[model samples]
Target: MENKEIILNILHEIKNGNIPVHTDYNLNLDMWADLIEYMHDRTYIADVTIYWFGDDDTYNDERVHSVNLTKVRLTTFGERFLTEEMN
Candidate 1:
């Protein structure tokens, strides 16, 4: 998917309030390694986090790290998406 699609999807996910997804929701579903790589480069997130994936394995051929979301929030973006979808 394109960069625009990526941001839009991320925003949509955020609005949903829950990180509700199938067990197989792809983090690296497309040729979107740039986004994942960029996230991996974050300083603060890396500091407080152990591993997004359960294992300590490095980001391999798989595009995404598995996330065990403890708490998910509904951002404004997600609310809009849901509102529009419901309508």
Candidate 2:
């Protein structure tokens, strides 16, 4: 699926109380970063973090920001985005 679709799917799942888990370290990391940024920028999702751990040994790439999808949930705007804009 496309990145947009994937993001919506993740949000839908989150809205329905499903937790998405990835065994791989880099599972959709780039896409997650973008989604996190987009949602935060638009105030769609709150209390979610897109952060660099600042530990080079753990996250070798300084450019890579980490997002824990399981720790994030859909905000009111995010729900509206999914139902109104994404449906």
Top lDDT prediction, candidate number: 2
lDDT of 1 by residue, 1-87 (tens): 554455445445544543423223354423333443333343101211223333446745443444433343444444555457546
TM-score of each predicted structure versus truth: 0.34, 0.64
Q: State residue 74's C-alpha deviation in candidate 2, in Å.
A: 1.4
lDDT of 2: 0.66
Cα lDDT tens digits, model 2, 1-87, are 665776677677778887654322245666557666786687766667666656457756655456766567678888888998564
- Which candidate's TM-score is highest? 2
Q: State the lDDT at 66 in candidate 1.
A: 44
> Candidate 1: lDDT of 2?
54
lDDT: worst 10-residue window of model 1: 42-51
Full-model lDDT for every candidate: 0.40, 0.66
RMSD of 1: 7.4
